[model samples]
Target: MMYKKLFLLSGLVLSLILVGCEFTKKTVNNVNLFTIEDDINLGLQVSQEIANDPKQFPILKEKGNEDVYRYIRKITNKILNSGKVVNRNNFKWQVKIIDDIETLNAFATPGGYIYVYTGLIKYLDSEDQLAGVMGHEIAHADQRHSTKQMTKSGALDLLLSAAIGEKEAVKQVVGGIVGLRFSRTHETEADEYSVRYLCGTDYNAAGAAGFFKKIGGAGSPPEFLSTHPNPDNRVQEIEARAKGMGCRGNSTNKTEYNRIKGLL
Candidate 1:
């Protein structure tokens, strides 16, 4: 009986390993363990938990900040509808602008939840720049960077703990996300997605590259810029990506962006 039990347990572990190692055929961000559904549920659970923490919620929250959020949603909706992304139909997309203007940061979770600081919006010069940031973040969400990172960063253990209903494991996953940064390869993949998503839209394909150039030139990297690859390296790659796409004569929408800033 003991020998049979051990065999069954080993088989279960091996099966889980196989599931996690299953690879998709996509050329970008293809390596992942969690199914789209698993990631979506994980993201929703974490987002809800984070939203419940009063200290965790940004000041002003989303209730009185509809205008800023509306502008962000407009950009996100347009990009999402561009049909350039994978797993598009698998998740419900949403975007929010945090009230903090000094943070200069933005991030997206596994599902479709994206958050941008007011500072990134104010710091940028044009709607194209905003699109650049938004597109990059949307790519992060679209590509399931959070889950990829989690899987790479001990999320397998967390998943097991979660299977056993370990609350601390859930907390650890949430806390880990706040400082999560993608690997260079993953960052590049997300950038590629950003460039592609912006191409057919009203925004320029090089918006992301331009934003990287500005941040690099400015010399004071914000938290958003901190975890990314060196701005110079990213800018060069983004330029190359933009050129490969044969994109030209893009709109910057500086006037409209200024108005959005004013709304904030």
Candidate 2:
């Protein structure tokens, strides 16, 4: 009886490993064990958790902040309409504003749930710059970087537990995403995709480069830079790519952007 039980357990482990391998094989750029559906579910779950935790998230309510939400939606919609995002129609793509002026950062969850800090919105100079940041964050979701990072960090066991309907494991996975740090390679891909996404729009293709230039020239890194480390020649690379693509749109719409800024 003991020998038979050992054999069964070994078979189960092997099966799980094979399942993980299969999922990993299906990913686009890296070894991601989660499927697109998994990303949607996980992002939805994490976003709900964030919504409930007002002390931590402080999401600005759309009740009296209709204009702000509308402005954000306009920017987000332009990028989404650019036709470059994967799973664009399937993912939620909900945008939320976290009302914290001190934290200058923006992030997207696995399935296109984006949260931007007020500090980041206030800090940017023009509409195109904000659009650039939004595009980069959207790329992170479209590319499923969070799950890829989770796979790399040995969260396979946790994922397996979640697969087996372990509720606590799911919660842990969702909770662990509070401050997930993406790799430099993922960051670069996001940056490149930002330009690519913007290239399809009227916004400046190298708008993201402007943000990097400002922060790098400022000499003091904000929370955004801390998570997204500005490597050498990042600006040059972005500008060069935009120029190489021959993207003609250079409209920053600074006057209108300043008007929106005044509303906040």
TM-score of each: 0.81, 0.82
Number of the top candidate by TM-score?
2
Model 1 Cα lDDT, one tens digit per residue, 64-125: 66776677788888788778877678876766666677767777777777778887888889
Q: What is the lDDT for 215 in model 2?
A: 78
Candidate 2, residues 1-264, lDDT tens digits: the string is 533442344222332322232222333337786788878877877787778789889999899889889999999998999989877898999999999988778888888999998988899999899998889889989888777866655565665555444666655655555555556667677888999999999999998888888777454553234334454477888899999999888889898888877877
Instruction: List residue ranges in candidate 1 displaced over 4 A.
Output: 1-30, 59-64, 160-166, 217-228
Q: Where does candidate 1 have its weakest 10-residue lDDT segment?
A: 15-24
Top-scoring candidate (lDDT): 2
